[model samples]
Target: MPFDFSQSHFVLFGLPTTFALDRAVLDTAYRKLQAEFHPDRFAAADDAQKRLSLQIATRVNEAYQTLKSPLARARYLLQLNGVDTQEDTNTAMPVDFLMQQMEWRETIADAKTQRNVDELEELNRQLAEEITELTVELAELLDEQHAWSDAATAVRKLRFLEKLNDEIGNAIEAVLF
Candidate 1:
């Protein structure tokens, strides 16, 4: 149980430290590591070894979660490259993007007020498309161009979009139920 907390998530998973990754490879590595570090495998070992196994298993889970999520992975990569996402410290965005966000919010509000599931579904579709586009841009910025600042900005946008998506899902559920 040689645990190295200093190792990056990618290093822990034997992955290249980059934004772009093969999902299959990541999933396979995660499963392999999970099985290897599973506490049950060390159940008969000494207390110290069992504790170490639990710690290693927890670390592996955390690494897998962060590496699997696009937004988290992007943020981690930016941090590794010496860029702070400034998710809390910096809220500034392009005026147009801000306006778009406001408009989307209004649209969601309208749909909720009217109890229109169809409208909510349409809005969800649009938001998903926007999220997909932003994800592609994020990958390009982090992997190909190494645009740290822009990548940080993109991460903020994705965070907002994800929140909005969750809200939309909640609203839809409310309307249906």
Candidate 2:
């Protein structure tokens, strides 16, 4: 089959290495491909064939997940381009972005001290909006403009936003609790 589950997501889906992808197309293709090579459909086949089918099915699920998430997709694109974001490397962001992050942290800290859930929620909303804007910026940098070097820097910022976003969610949960 042309769509080899063992192949990378880009190869399997015939997509370019980019964050922006047609979700509908990916989902539809996955469903159709699943239907075709489902192990159950090959129940009458030999043991090796059935095992191979199972392996291929697992690969398809893994690839789908990696492609679905923006962060994962970005990391994958980086790897494909011979860039390795070291697993242990601490993300170093620019001073302006660091200053913005510090402001966010201060706001969160101040809100917590004041015991203001509304303020916390508002901060979360703002961060969420910023994350959305960064996501679009990432797509433009990686796909439209072909700016990998710049995109690499943006990805580092994105990692920070992701961490902050998770912290905000946890903060909300703590408030609710």
Candidate 3:
């Protein structure tokens, strides 16, 4: 009841406003808030109290989900400041980046066609390493450097890596089946 429904997630939880969050603190805040505002805790109260509890609970869930993922957190921060991160509108990736992606896709396709598990595993390993590097780059841009523009670029790279990850998984499944 003391917490304001009008507050943002960081404000509601009395947390600092930042792109990179401490997971432990976030989890603790989420658990504490959920326990405080859970509808079950308001079941014995009047109808209005129960309804308010439900709304607060829903807000908490939305905040938790948005703050938990790097991609979602970045997007939320941009939206919070009235910025449209129209990643798709740019549609102009460097040609070298596109070529690299195509090469990886081709390598994956060839590996699957030959039922070469070793090649698939090696590709997966390389992709995983690359993704890890991209993650670090994103963290540095978003957290340490506070370079939102560069962070946006990093997000694009991360998205591409995510797509490649899915494609690699599909290739693995095909080889297995």
Top-scoring candidate (TM-score): 1
The C-alpha RMSD in Å for every predicted model, in order, reads 0.9, 2.4, 2.4
TM-score for all models, in order of appearance: 0.97, 0.85, 0.82
lDDT of 3 by residue, 41-125 (tens): 9999999989989999999999999888777777776566566666787655678888999999999999999998889889899
Runs off by more than 4 Å, candidate 2: 1-6, 40-45
Please identify which of the two predictions, 1 or 3, would achieve the higher lDDT against the true structure: 1
What are the clashing pairs of model 1?
Answer: none
Estimate, for each residue in 1-177, the C-alpha lDDT of model 2 and write its tens digit. 334545678777667666889888888878876887788987998998888888777777888898988877877887787776553485677788999999998887777777778988998889889888988998998788878777777778878888888877777777777
Scanning candidate 2 in windows of ten residues, the lowest lDDT window is: 1-10
Q: Best by lDDT, which number? A: 1
Per-model CA lDDT versus the true structure: 0.94, 0.80, 0.82
> How many backbone clashes can be found in candidate 1?
0
Select the stronger candidate by lDDT from 2 and 3. 3
By TM-score: ranked, best first: 1, 2, 3
lDDT over C-alpha atoms for residue 139 of model 3: 72
Model 1 lDDT per residue over 1-177, tens place: 677889999998899999889999999999999999999999999999999999999999999999999999999999888999999989899999999999989988899989999999999999999999999999999999999999999999999999999999999998889
Model 2 scores a C-alpha lDDT of 0.80
